[model samples]
Target: MKKYIIILSSVIIIIALGGIYMKHQYDERQEKNKTAESELYEKAKKRMTDYINANYEGIDKINFSNNYKMDQMGGINAEGYLNGDKSKEFWGIYDKSNNIITSSYVDAKEKPACKEKPCKY
Candidate 1:
């Protein structure tokens, strides 16, 4: 009886260790995925900025009109002056140039506009 009890305890201990090891492996994989996603977003943001600078010259104070999601791609509509016109509108992709180059325009739910403080238009 004592020998059988000892064997059962040893088996339980081994199973527990195996479970812990699997849990650690799962956590590590999730961390790696998160890191990769973060890097991708950083790259996307930089690409978007560079494209805007190269294509849209003489435009300043550019702001994102909509919330950016990491899981999906979208576009942002910007309102700014071009050569002091103060009436030009720019609609382009969030982090890609293909949409802009192909002339794909996405309707922005909330358009960004220049505003002054104290309710001044």
Candidate 2:
């Protein structure tokens, strides 16, 4: 009876240790995923801003619907679209302060080449 009790205790300890190890691994994976997601968000925001600065001159305010469709394109793909869409109203601003253009969304079109100031979207 004593031997049997010892054997059962040993088995329980092993199982408990295994469970703890698995939980640690799961937590690590979750943290990694969260970090990756955060990095992607930052990259997307930067790309959007750069696009806006290059395309429009004298931007004052950028307005867009709340449904900005951020998920459809991840970081790299979203940057590509910003580079390509000339007509998309992705940025707006009211004034250039300290040579900085501020907008709600990044407009990703080349500064208008024509001499006449382009019409606001």
Per-model TM-score versus the true fold: 0.52, 0.51
- Model 2, 39-109: lDDT tens digits are 65454445445545545566544333332233332322232223344455553332222223233444333
lDDT, candidate 2, at 7: 100
Each candidate: how many clashes?
0, 12
Estimate, for each residue in 34-96, the C-alpha lDDT of model 1 and write its tens digit.
Answer: 776556545544544444454444545444333334424443333222333434444433334
Q: Which stretches of model 1 miss by more than 4 angstroms?
A: 57-121
Backbone steric clashes in candidate 1, count: 0
